[model samples]
Target: MSDQLNTRQARRQAQKKKQNSNNKGKSKKQLIKKIAIATAIAIAVAIIATGITVFAIISNAPELDEEQLMLTQGALMYDQNDEFVSQLESSERRMNVSISDVPSVVQDAFIAVEDIRFRDHFGIDIRRLFGAVAANITDGFGAEGASTITQQLVKNLFLENDKLMSRKIQEQYLAIKLEQQYSKDQILEMYLNQIYLGSGVYGIELASQRYFNKTVEELSLADAALLAGIPRRPSFYDPTVNPEAAESRRNLVLSLMVQHGKITEEEAAEAEAISIEEQLDVTEREAYAYEAFYNLVLNELEEIDGITSSDIYNSGLKVYTTLDTDAQEHVETVLQTSEYIQNYPDNEDFQAAITLLDTETGQIKAVGSGREDSGQQRGFNYATEAKRQIGSTAKPLLDYGPAIEYLQWSTGHMITDEPHSYSDGTEINNFDGTFQGRMSMRRALAASRNVPAVKALQEVGTDRAKEFGEQLGMSIDTMHESYGLGAIPLSTKDLAGAYAAFGNNGTYTQPYSVRKVEFPDGRVLEFEPESQMAMSDYTAYMVTDMLKTAVTDGTGGTANISGLPMAGKTGTTNFDRDTREQYNIPANAAPDIWFAGYTTKYTAAVWTGFNQHSENNYFPSQDSSRQIAQQIFKAVVEEVSSTIETPDFTMPNSVVRVGVERSTGYYQVILRQVVRLFMNYLYVVMSRLEYQKNLSTLNLLAI
Candidate 1:
């Protein structure tokens, strides 16, 4: 009876255990099903939310109006001869070629490099987009861009060049709309024309002409591939300026072309065999040349009545500049080869500037800041901006020109070159400290004597002198005696214009680079330079004649040409210790050198100095500045000699050449004191004796 009871209890327990195990299995299965349903519901919500967001994005995106997609056709600048000089700095510089004008090979080149599925895709490539997203997620940010040609066109035309996610999202929305609105060929044509290639060249047409000197329809396969690679990173892959980088880019394009079956492997190999240098027809970039001349043009344009820099840079207006491309190239070559520029120990720190202007029209022919890679920022051309103390180059504008004009002083007028103390207790000294005692105004100016210049400035009141300089286009800020010695600062352009007045027969026509502008709608605006008769023709001739002595036998003697009648002034501002200390700069920093002069056809200014303080700023000798200026002048004279004739200054009817005794002088009018007058006359006699002695010594040497 006990065993039967035990067996029954055990069986009951086993049954209960089996039932509990079955219930547990059923609950676990039900729980798994509920979890699965919840997960499915969450996934559905995510999909619906994503769909709603995309719908909202597309619905709210901007319309594809024709105006919304209007392209920026930047300004084109032409030289005087109507040949393309360069495309000015602009947001876009495109020459739109129709699909018919664009060759098949050119299209293929862009497609293979930029977007292989460009024709097949509606607008955006899903595979590429997802891959780019994956890459970004993996690598954090900006890991890749999978922009198709359509997307690029949208980004360039409709949006600012931003790389944010918002931009990308908007890019896709507009690209899809663009694909729907325009035909495939239309979209492709727009893409080809609206893209930015290197060196301010936009579109395939301009790019082809710029790189290979060919039209889009005439591009060879290699040329096409090379151009297509530039929009990737214009500056980094500039074919003309950065060839090694360009070659690598070109090869990648060629390889892509072969992989896409657009070109055969053998064909790509042949194209690759041709070196970048051999394939590229362009020898040098005209972009920097354009920047140099355009900076000057931009300044003048700002003064126009209805023009702004924005209008010139963004509008499709055509700018006709007075820039002589050949002359500009020549000047660049001369600067590169000149001794001061070439022999400078520190290549990066030393700076020089050159400005050439047409004397008759006041047209800027050429300009350079320093070397090609002087780290000069755009629009800050040192040629037009570096207003260094102009040194003795100011003597003619400040002292001689005014003295001859207002004071009725002749070149032969006697002057004392001894040190003088002004009423303000300021002492004036000659450059070398040893005075020549007395000299003719012509001799004093030729030698750039500080005392004589100050005396002349005093004779013509400083106020009047400043007025005269202003009329000639100089900015004379101070009326101090030191102003006579070029303590007043001025730019190379200002000095060149001032000197050009002498060559222009005393007419100061404001310097200009843009001669005319043609808007896209066929409206033409002409630029006429504002000019005035700043001085009499007689005075201009007299001053120019006196300046001739400088080139022939004075400080600028090295600047003389064998058969050219050129006149110029050499200005060397010796290092000012006090000024250096005041500025807390190096002792070698204060000195600035200049050569301002003009021929019958052209006037030029050349300046040499350290742009920034450097240990190598020490000039080789006292005459080193003048020697350097002469080298530059000779080079330029030789360059343009064949093109323009060096004519003599026209003698005006009002001027009369006369000889006078060294003692009977125009002295009392300048100095009120009789004793001072006698001393000045005595110095004149002493200078004449010294001049005669030098003349005799030269004659003996010749014998």
Candidate 2:
């Protein structure tokens, strides 16, 4: 009975072990099934999120404007007379050509190198896109791009050049949309017209004309291949700039053509044999007639609040400028042609710049950037850009103007012109190295004496002088006694604007070139310069009177025009001893010479010197070179005044002319002497009465 019971217990124990193992296997299978279901749900959610984000981005893309895809027009500039002057040089110089006119070989060359499977694929090449994506994933984003010709066209037209993912999506979406709307031939034509080739040229037609001086239909296979290679890197592969690089690129394009079966190997070899230089006949575009004034307009456009240089170049805007064409032409002629000026310098290195402004409006009417047109577009503009030291011209503007405005000093206020030194013990000397003592303020300013100007600045205070200069639009960076003798540097534009205040009865109007800009969509941007009272009318008159005397009898005598009611100041800057020794310059040589003058109708500032102050370039002590600025100023004033009716400078009612004795430098010495004699006689009579009264008192005491 014990053996049978033991067998039953063992059987039950084995059955229980088998049941536990089966239950563990079932639990493992159930866990695997639940994980698979959760993974599928997560992937579906990710797909939905990506789809929604892409859809939002595509919806927010810029609306397609078919008209903008057409050939772009350059901005136009009109003069103050509302007359057409010239077309501004835009970023793209494209002349559209029909697809039928484009040679088949030319089209094949572009397609061979740019996009090999252009015709076989949709707007996006899926294989190339995937390869680029894989490359980017491995080497970080923005490492590669798979842009089709259609993609490039849309980006050039509508999108900013940025490496953002969103921008790329918008570009691709717009490209696909464009392909759907237009035929293949139309898209090809547009792409050819839109690509920037080189040398400020756009489109194959213009590129052909610019490089080969021929029509698009006349391009040889080598010529077409060379042009096709330039779009890869315009500046780097430009034939005129880098001929060897351009030739290498052209050969690569030919090889690409042969590889794609667009041309026979023998034909490709023949085309590659021809050097890029031989196939090229470069033709330069003629510079605009009003290039200097146009350059000023471009600079002004850049400073406007919302406008950019791209807008000026790409947008079909109309710029209305304050350029008086007649005055501009005259000024240019005077600067270029020596016959128009008197005592003109004969040195080739000698350069002169002049700026003319309407005194009442502060509008820049004419600007001569140099002695001649540099012919380089947007070259260094000396008139508005170059800054040089202004000499004695500062005396009237910095020293005396502030004195009269703040100190109320009469024109005959006495100031001794003697040898003096600054607070730092720097000795000041007159230009002639001699002092004329006890001179009136008017005479001292007319003579441009160094001592009196320093004295006047000391009396008014340097801080106040700088403040007064700032009010008149003069940039005074340092407060020093030498500023009274015109030690500060200023551009011709700056000087002209400052002097205009004197001519405009103390009102300062900020100088500007552009009047208004009219956009393509009927939006107009008007530029109204800031105007403020720079000084009282009395101060303006006092300074103008002194400067008038300066033109008539002082350093600016040569700049005086015969019939024009003008006031002006002359300035000359010298080299230090060290500079003279280093360059072996003459003792009397001047690095810069200026003649700044103005009429009631206009203000003109002329500067003449070498752009560089080397031994080979400097103004000698001869009258012609030293006084070139005056001659230019005189010529410009004579020519510009003839076109406009200029009235004399009107004296303000608040300013009164007072007579002073020339010898004593005071009001009527004769009257002062007579009053002194009468007072002495009255004192003698009173003394005699006092003595008699004293004698009477003594007699009464004795009684």
Candidate 3:
């Protein structure tokens, strides 16, 4: 009976234990399931937060201009016909792209260079990020770029290019968002368009046009590779200057295309046959007047208000400028001609400038700020800025007009040729001490006589000289000085215009750079020169008469031309404080030689000197300035003379011939001697008659 009871109890106990064990097992399973559910819910919330953050990130990017326009700079040049002559370019080129149409090979090459594993990963590649971070930690700078192509586009197009890691983090995050929202092709297209391809090519189309001068569709594999190669180092690999480097980079692109199987080995080999010329035929660096054009453009850019340089440099703009390509070429040719540059050996050390302007309207016909073959560095530009001393050229503009109009000094008025003391006791004299005791004022000027000029200026007064120059458009500051003997700091440009008063019939025409400027949108800015009458027509004629003599009979004789009315003057400054440089008697060669002259149609001035204001100590001992200056003027006049009709010279309407002495300033016409060979017979006959008459009268008196 105990065994049965024990067995029954054992069976009951076993059942109870089995129920408890199963309950325990069920509780364990429930706990495990709950933990799994909690983890999945947390993961889902995190994903929701990430999606919202990415959505917000993509919305805050740098917006792009709908119309892709490049920034351009240009200048205005008006021709005699008042037509636009030329336009110059001053900016980089940017290209546009099609998101889906981008060639896969080019896209893959970008990936290889910018970001590896681009296809398999999101915009932010953690593996690359970790490696970059580690390297940055050790290297102290983020030398390695962890940015994917999409991240780069985000930074370049939208986000500011900050060096901070925070910005980089934002870039990475935004890139990931961009990857999810836009297709791989779309990102690539944006990147190619945003990337800087140098040589003034911006968008893909322009790049194709600028480099290959063809359409994008026409690009071969090698050509495509070459285009891809420029962005990495545009200046360093510039094909114009460094073709080898550009070629090397191009080959690298070809190898990568071949390695990626985007192009076959055979295609890569054929690329060699295509040659660098086939890829990019011309380089913008080799463009005409590239430096001067850009320089002028940069200067003009300062006029606009509230525009960033980037907007000016990058925005694709169509600029209509005054630069004439043909004129620019000619100006360059004239500047580099043997006549202009060959004279300056070791020209790199010296600098000079020349400018040409129209007389009717003061539009700049041509301008050369420096030598043409001066390599890359344009030396000192004397055209607009260099203040050289104007020697005798300013005399006609100052002394002669005032002497004629105010002092009523006639051309034939006699003046002593001896030395005279000034207020400071400084003695001045004629070219030689042996002065013509008396001579006509016209002859003195024709001879470039110093004493007669001084006497006339003394009569006109120092203030009058200054006033006359001011009338002729010369700054009074330059006009007021004791150096009226020849000292005046002036530029070649101002000198030319001041002398143009003669060409304009004693009316000064101010120099003009922009004859007209028209915007691409048809807005025009035009300028017309106003003629400022500086002297009376009669006084002008008087001065021109003397100046004509200067060219015809004075030191300016070298510049004389018959059959055309020409007037000019020669000037020399003292190489020493005591001697003149232009008309210097101390040195055989004049320091600064100028022949400022005018015909009916043109007023031209030429000045030749060393680049620096070398000390007056070194006498200009070679080349009479008259020779070269007149040669240049003569050549220019001859070249352009036939284009214009000869101008008529109207003589002075009235002449005030005062009763000044012929031999002296006093009223005296002293006759000296007259001899005749047959006078002996007449004298004999008269003596015989006089004697007979006296005898007859004496006999009549005696009777």
Candidate 4:
């Protein structure tokens, strides 16, 4: 009985212990389950938060403009007469073609290389996106791009190119919207049209034309593959720029087509074997005939508010320029024809630039950038771009103009033309290497005497001279006396526009190329240069009179147009002693020569020289080369003046002609006083002699 009782008690104790162990195991399992539930809740919350953020960003994305998906038109340029000149040069060169015109093989070539799943996916390819994300995570950000054709199209049309997350979200959102609106065929067609290909080409059609000189419809499999590869890296895969790299890229595209089962392996092999150069028949787009003027118009367009170079090329903008086609043609003829510019150097490297402007309006009538057409689009525009040392042309604008304006000096004002030096002991010499002792300002200016010009600038003060020059559209940044001799460089455009102040009765208008810009949105931007008074009327007249003497009997004589009332100046810049010694240049050789002149109706500036000056590349001392600028100026003015009725430069009422002694440059009033005093002395002498004779006779009678 006792053992039974003990055994029952032990069993009861064992049961209690087993029950406690079971309760502990249940508590452990319950804690783990709670932890798992919390973790799942956190993940679910995070996913919901991300979804909300993405939806917010997508909702704020830009609305797609269906019209922008169409082909964009290039800007149109017109002349002063409103006649079409040429289409403005743009970075985007596109020729739109319908989807039907593109061959199936060419379409498949793009689809295979650009986006293999283009046909089946929505605008955003989820599989490709996930693969790109995984690749990025494994490597780094931007390791791969998963943008579909639709995404790229939307980015090009409506989105800024950046790597921002918001931009990516918006791009994807727009792509989806675009897919919902257009069919797959339509999207592909738009992509082919909007995609940027190599060599400034924007579409497959233009790419076909640019590379093969053929249409997209006529492209072979290899040709289509070559074009298809360029959009990936346009410059790197440009056939003309990098033929080998382009061929390799093309082969890769062909292989991709085979892998995607769009083309047979045999077809891919055959296409890869063909050399890119063999199929290439590069068609260079012909530049506009008036490319110089067109380039000027384009430059002006860039300055307009809200107008960019892309807008000028793709916005279908209409630009009316100040170009007078007849004058432009005549100017070109004069610069190109040997007969007109008989003094042009025989060397092909010799270049010339000229700018002609209407006197009163400051309109750029014509511009000649080079003596010979370079046949390059937007080549160096010397007329507006090349700034060379103006030489002695600075005399009238920098030195004497300020002198007369500030000092009220007349044309007869005297200046000594002798060996001189600045206060800093810098020697100044005349161009002819000899100096006249003293002469009227008119004679000094007409002869372009360097010493007198420097002296005039000294008397007027460099500060005042610079201020005066600035009023005339010159950017004078130096206070040195050499500036008086045109050590400062200026373009033909600046010279021509500045000289117009004299003919315009002291009014200066900034020269402009484009008259107006008309946008596709019906907004017109007219560019009318504001007129400012650069000098007093009498000051202008005085300078004009002196310049007239320069043209008639001075260094500018070579540029004079017969029977045309004109005022002009000539300028020549020389190499320094060190340069001359280094290059073994002759004493008479110059780097740049200029003739800036204006008739009553027009103003023109001509510059002639080698683009760069070396011992063998300089303008020789020969009459033809040295006087080439003058001769060209004469021809250009003669041609342009034939069409306009040129009148004489009108003298203002405040300007009066005064007589002065040519020898002494003394005023006529002072000479008249001397004559009167001399006559009075003679009369007194005669009266005194008569009195002496009468006294002598009286003395004789007394004796």
Candidate 5:
């Protein structure tokens, strides 16, 4: 009875233990089920969030202008004779070729260097992208580029060169779209065509021609490898300038080709041993030799409506300038063949500038800013930018013109040429030390008498003279009394325009360089000069008549062009204070000289001086600044006279010729001559008496 009772108890205890074990198993399974459900919900939420982000990025993408993708063409410049001058460089050199046309080695070499997985990826390579991100985080800067060829093409064509995250994302998106639109071969072709190689060379075709003097199909394995290396850093790897670096880069490309199974080990080794110098055939590119003229054309083209300077330099439009090729060539020849240029001073301080303008239309016919061969480190445009004192050239613009217009002074009107003091307490004297007392306006101006010019300015009032000068395009806005003596600074170009007004019947026309710009699509933008009446025809005629007298028989006699009816003025500034300060000199001497002259056909101005304002200590024998001007003027005028008949200056009805005796009208003229004659006779008699006394004294000594 006791055994049975014990057995029953043990069985009950076992059953209870079994039931507890089963309950624990069920609890473990339920816990695992809850955890799995929570994890699945979290994963679903994450996927939904990722989809939302991608959708937002795609929906808010910025719109791109398709026209911007079109390749930029360079502008062509032509002379007036329709001769090709130069091409204004704009975009890259490019020649599109199909994948079949490209050598297999060429395609393989570029693929190995630029992008190894170019064929397998769909625009963006996720594995390479993640790897690049990790490397960029670990390194100081991001040196690894995971961009595929498709990505690069899209970034170059459709996006700016910004390295921000947003730009990268846009680039990726556009690259994916481009990949869908175009085949892999097509993208590769575009990439090869659009990339910049070096030395202003763009595209593989141009690079092949420039470096190897061969086409893409003619390239060897070594040649292909070398060209593939240049697009990475053109300047640093340029075969001509840096052959060692270029060779190193080429060897690296060959090694990459070997690693990528594109080229065998033996082939890579052989190509690596090849010299880039042997393959290089760099030649000087054809360019325009006229620097100032090219610069002027570029400057003028910048002001057009649809064209910018970029268009002139890169868009490949044709620019037809107002430059007459014959005139330009003649002017350049005259300046280069001049005795002054042949024997130019060794000192950098000395420089010369000349500008010629057409009277019929204010076209800049020819410009010589500096020596054509001067390899000057500092670019000083003496014709347009450098301003120097014009001296007596101001006589016509500031003194005589204003005097005739406002004070009703005629060419023969009497004006005293004695020393004069202005209201500002400034005193001025004539060019020569001794003045002729009094002289007619024509003689004063022709002789370039400083005192007379100052007095004339006073008669017309300095304020009025300033206005009159400004109207004629002279930049004389100073209130100083010395302005009548050409103390104001002006450029040769500005002076040329101001002088052209006199020949153009008092009409001030703005000078222009480019006559017209034609677009690649045959659209034309023409340039018309702006003109305004600057002075009365009568006043201009009077001033011109006085200037003609100057060239004929006055201070400007050096500039007389025989058989050419011309009028001009000569200006010389004696010892500039600025020059003295610059050189720390004790005395002042004339440093700046100018000759401004005009005919009915053209007006020209020549400036000669030291760029550094050197002291006037040294003087050359054969080439004084004035003599140089005379040579230049004669040469250019003779060339122009060959083409056109020399026309006479038209006289206006308001100007009438009135003759006057040389020594009769003014108070000092007759009286000074008579007194001078009597004094001369008395001196002769006294000298004869003194001689007799000396002779008598000698005879007494001998006795």
Candidate 6:
């Protein structure tokens, strides 16, 4: 009985041990499940944190305000009245042109060449991205840009100038947001206006106008296609300098358009049949075109707020300025086309410019920078930039005008025309250096006699000349000090304003380009020289009177207006005059001759020459400057004199008297006070005939 009981207990013990081993295996499996659940939770938390950071970055990208956007676009110049001038930058073809108003063909042409699926993609095209990546990896950078219209807009509006991955990231994020906020059409319009095509073209309309001289509406299928080809490589396909290459490129664009179904193969063939123009194949950009007035407004705008150049274009501020539109156009047309019959084709060297201003309001009416394709931005704006040696032109304000206004010097006041050494050792006279035995200020000025002017300056003192110029708004104390005899540099613009004091009855109206600057919202920030005055009324009248005698009988005789009371001066810079003679060639070249004159209707300044020197050995010297400048001035004046009524130039009292006697600083006569007034009719009216003095004393006094 005892042995049976022990076997039963042992079997039961074995069963219990097997049960414990199974439980251990199950517990281990349960532990592994808990660990996996914890791992997945940790990964989920990390992913959420990462997404939030990325979202924050996407939410806070840099962007441009309306004004800033427009500035980046670069379109701000306007007429005095705030009318549109030219669009400098931007892509929407946004030129105050509405999307619906634009021709469908233009729209299609751009879409075809740029991003085909632009209409469907929500700012980003995965397909294009992949293609761009493939191209970047296989080909080279810039070979393909995956920037959709919206992406490009974002890049232009929000991104910096650097092309980097950081900028690309920002662009992608902003592009998606832009697509959500703006319509495809709005984005497309902005894109067209903002992309830079070439030749300073900014918008589709301007691009059309520049490349075809035709309106966007007027652009043919072929023309539209050719223009579309420009955006990819503007400098490369520039039709102006490279034609055959541009043609090939344009044909490729056509092929792309056909492949993309934007145009039919038949249409592409027709476009291919179209001939490509080798030069300014579109329309020519007119030179100057009121550049002076435009610059004036620009400067003032820079100081003000709201009315930026881009705002001016899109906002269309009513810039009611002082410019006389007709006068501006007249001056510009005359200078550009009808004035000079010749020009230096493309100056491989040198540059030139011109500007004309309004005498009454100091408004710039016209300006020129030669040919549009000169690849120069009015570099050496002769009107304001060039510090050239102005010959007789400077003498008027420095020597003659000051003498009469400040020194009690009369136009009839006589001075010897014979050459003499100055304290500095410089000797000057007329161009020929021929001493007129005896003459009046009238004769001397009419002939541009240098010795008489130098003597007059000597009598007036160089300091006095400096003082006079400073009074007239010339920023030249140093120049004034060196005003000995055309030693100081002067610009056409400054000189014109100085002479204008006479036209304006002595009030020097400071010349300005911009009329007024208005914020984009139509609030004006600056109106240049609202109270600008360059000289006093008395001084202005005095100077104008002297200039009258100059144009009427002086060296500016070539500038006389038949039925008008006109006054002006001739400026011949010291360049190569005649290489054959010793000191024969003057200081500047001849092509820089000038005729700054004014009538009741228009005050114009003319400068002529091949703006650039040719590589073919033709140096555009002073001779070219004189013959062209004077003739152009004459032609322009003659045209106006025939049609426009002449206005009255304020007549100042007294006149320029010459030949009194420089030998003794007095007239050669019985009484020391008896001045042998050459051209004695000047003022023929100052009744103060003077005091008792011996002839010896008077001759000594006059000289």
Give the whole-model CA lDDT for all candidates, comma-separated: 0.74, 0.80, 0.59, 0.80, 0.72, 0.60
Model 4, 216-247: lDDT tens digits are 99999999999889876665677775788999
Candidate numbers, best lDDT first, in rank order: 2, 4, 1, 5, 6, 3
Query: TM-score for all predictions?
Result: 0.58, 0.64, 0.52, 0.64, 0.58, 0.54
Pick by TM-score: 1 or 3, better one: 1
Query: Which window of 10 residues has the lowest lDDT sum in candidate 6?
Result: 684-693
Return the lDDT, model 2, position 237: 82
Q: Write the per-residue lDDT of candidate 3 for residues 337-380, one digit (tens) a residue.
A: 76533444443434345555555555455455656454322323
lDDT score for candidate 3 against the true structure: 0.59
lDDT per residue as tens, model 2, 1-703: 8999999999998998888888988988889888888888888889999889888988888877887887466669999988888885544377889999999989998998888877866678788899999989999887899888888778767765567888889989998888899888898998888776766567899899999999999999999999999877665687865788999999999999998899999999999889876898877675577887886787677566555333455556799999999999988889988676656655666788999999999999999988653322223468987788899888888899988888877676789999899878999888878999997787898888889999999999999999999998886677788877877988899999999999999999988989988876577889879899999887887788878889888888889898778999999888989999999988877889998999998999989887666786777775567777998898888987887788888877666543343333333212323534543211000112223433343222100
The global Cα lDDT (0 to 1) of model 1 is: 0.74
Ranking 2 against 3 by TM-score, winner = 2
Please, what are the lDDT tens digits per residue for candidate 5 over residues 562-664? Answer: 8898999988776656656777654424666788999999888988766554444433322354466655665676677776897899876555443223334
Indicate the residue-level lDDT of 507 in model 6. 67
Candidate 1 structure quality by residue, lDDT tens digits, 1-703: 9999999999999999999999999999999999999999999999999888777766765556575345565667888787887665434355778998888988898998888999899899998989999999998656898898898777655553446666677889898878988988998987777676765566788777777778888888889889888877665587755678898998999999998899999999999998986776642434544577875675566566555333454455688988888888787777666543344434465567788888888988888656655543223467886788888998998888888788677677778888686658788777666888867888998888888888888889889998998898776566777777887887788888989999888999877788898865467789877899999787788888888888887888877877777789998776676655555554333357788888889888988776665444545454344366666766776577766667788766566543332345432212224334443332121122223434443221100
Question: Clash number for every model?
Answer: 0, 0, 35, 0, 10, 80
Q: What local lDDT score does residue 638 receive in model 1, on the 0 to 100 scale?
A: 57
Residue 587 accuracy (lDDT) in model 2: 85
Question: Clashing residue pairs in candidate 1, if any?
Answer: none
Q: Provide the lowest-lDDT 10-residue window in model 5.
A: 680-689
Show where candidate 2 strays beyond 4 Å: 1-62, 65-70, 89-285, 373-378, 668-703
Off by over 4 Å in 3: 1-85, 91-335, 339-353, 373-376, 429-436, 478-481, 577-589, 613-619, 622-626, 652-703
